[model samples]
Target: MLRIITEPTEAKTELERISGRTQGGETLQQEAAVREILQAVKRVGDEALLDYTAKFDGQVLKAEQLRVSGSELDAAYHQVSREFVDAITLACRQIKAFHRQRMPKSWVQFGQDEIVLGKRYNAVDRAGLYVPGGRAAYPSTVLMNAIPAQVAQVPRIVMVTPPGEDGKVNPAVLVAAQEAGVSEIYRVGGAQAVAALAYGTKTLPKVDVITGPGNIYVTLAKKMVYGVVGIDSLAGPSEVLIIADQQAKAVHVAADLLAQAEHDPMAAAILLTTDETLAKQVKQEVEQQLRNHPRRLLTEKAIAHYGLIVVVDSLSRAAELSNLFAPEHLELEIAEPWDLLEQIRHAGAIFLGNSTPEAVGDYLAGPNHTLPTSGAARYASALGVETFMKHSSLIQYSPTALQKVSNAIETLAKAEGLHSHSESVRLRREMDNG
Candidate 1:
């Protein structure tokens, strides 16, 4: 059962438990394991990758069988139902549209005397996306991670996922990748997969950036290899904060909270409501709904460990607590959601009204579902075209423009006691004068 906190003091304690240190107590061990795996991959290249695939994923795949071929992708499409294929295609279109609008555009401006300054946006040469494939198939993840790279015009988009016991990738994932326009797909995952992308193996090429969520091992691996290669974020367990009022439906709120709870045992599901009666009702509803979910065990563990229902004095207090938590997914299930929306200052993604559930954003809604987890919403944002592109500042100064700022530059340089720095500008000024 979820903890019920009524007093402000209890609320603070419960909120700490919910938003506190993420999947703690494993950082050092995870970092060590990741370092070992990364070093092994770095030393042995493709051989180490293959060995780890067998040891961890239980599939002994050769280098030739690592990359999924065109025929295999076609077969994967045939494996899934037509409805699923159509749904994937539709999702691809929606995600593509959302990212297209958010893509940064290069711009140039011509100032007087050719003192031009602007920026140019360019996509990375290659991007590697990791898709989790342990308990469930994540075709949606494939679409979320790969579509932005496609929209950003990445030259090559490669995806890595662990193969199943049969040494085959999930067909649904393959179909989604094909729909999202991925350039390559590999059968690898865990820290080994991250290593393969960071330091290119004999078969897998090193990528400019890696994106997507995974378990602790994968997250730590990304963190260790950050400078060697770019990573999206050091994602932690999933989290959701629902701000509801007496007018909100307990069942909907409960279901939404459980949606994130079922993601992982460390996942957090928090409910902030003004009505004590509603808080109790929603807690009961969550347990009742859990009975029917296939992942009831996992959801139950998550709720028992980190879940909480806080009864605040007013809706404003609820909003304040929600902002403090900075949850990955925040749902406003109240009478006037939009009115309270202005009160929410932080959150990765906001679901307005009862109809707009977090699940909608996860699947078909035009927003990228890859969000910042573990209070990261306080600063980071959801995955988008900007994540896959690089920005370069453009600057140009003509002789006249240089002359306009030469004196100021010399004065500042001289103030810093750098004679050489000032002399560079002084020399140029002398040439102009001559």
Candidate 2:
């Protein structure tokens, strides 16, 4: 059953416990295992990928079969329905449009004495996208990860996903990848796939950045390979924190919470409300809805362990709690949502008004759904075109500009006891003077 906390101290303690719910001691052991996998792939490349795929995924694959053929890409469209294509196409358009606005522009500004200063933004040569495969086929994840790289104009975008026992990638996932302009895909996943992308196998080229969510192993692999290549944030399980008032419908609130809980057994669904009566109603509604749920076993596990409800005295207190958690998804299902939004300081994504569920953001809402989790919203942001591109500082100084600052540069360089650093500036000034 979902627990409700009335006391502020208990609520704080419970929220902290949930935020740090990730495995503690087991993580060290897992990291050691992941390190072995990474080193194996780094050493032998494609051979290691094939060996690991067969061992972990229970599907045997040959080196030639690692990369998905062009014929398979064509066949994927036929495998999925037209409705899915149309829907994915629309999502592609929406996501592309949204990220296009987020593309960082290269700019230069002239300053006094003809000093040039700005930044130059450019896309990475190649980008690797990891799409998790197991519980469900995530076409949306393909769009969310791929479209941003596409908008950033990443050249040679490649995808990696685990194949089914039949050694076939999910049709909808392939279709979404193609729709989002990623056709170079491989039928591989897990830490080995991450290793291949990072270390560069003979079949899979090394990528500049890897983006997508996966299980603990994949997350650890990304963490390990971060210095070798750029990556999106270390994504944790999905979570939603809903602050609803009496005006919000109990059924709607319950459905929204369940939507998050259904993602995984570790997913969290929390609600903070000013109305105790409404809180009770929502709890009952959640149980009533779970009775006939298809994923009841997993969803119930999530709700029973990570789910929570807190009846606060005011909406301000609710906002305070929500900020403290820094949830991946935050919904304001209250009368004056905009008014309350001002009080919110942290959250990966915020859904305003009663109608805007996290599902909309998960699907065709245009914003990238690849958001920070596990309190990372305190310092991080959602994945976007910025993830696939990098900026270089642009600096150029005229002879006049160099002369003006040469003495100060020499003084600072001498203070640091670096003769060559001081000489470089001194020579430029002397040449101009001579």
Best-matching candidate per TM-score: 2
Task: TM-score each candidate.
Answer: 0.97, 0.98
Poorly placed runs, candidate 2 (over 4 Å): 23-26
lDDT of each: 0.89, 0.94
Instruction: Quote the positional error of residue 200 for candidate 1 in Å.
Output: 0.5
Give me the candidate number with maximum lDDT.
Answer: 2
Off by over 4 Å in 1: none
Q: How far is candidate 2 from the true structure (C-alpha RMSD, Å)?
A: 1.0
Worst 10 residues of 2 by lDDT: 20-29
Please give the lDDT score for candidate 1: 0.89
Clashes of 2: 0
Query: What would the per-residue lDDT of candidate 1 be over residues 1-434, giving only the tens digit for each residue?
Result: 89888899878767766677574646677778889999999999999999999899888888899998888898997799999988888888888888889988899999999989899999999999999999899999999999899989999999999999889999999989888888499999999999999999889999999999998899888988999888899888889998888889888888888989899898898888888899889888987898879998888999999888888888899888888889899998888999998899989999999899999899988798889877778899999888889999999999899999999999999999999999998899899999
Clashes of each: 0, 0
Candidate 1 TM-score, true structure as reference:
0.97
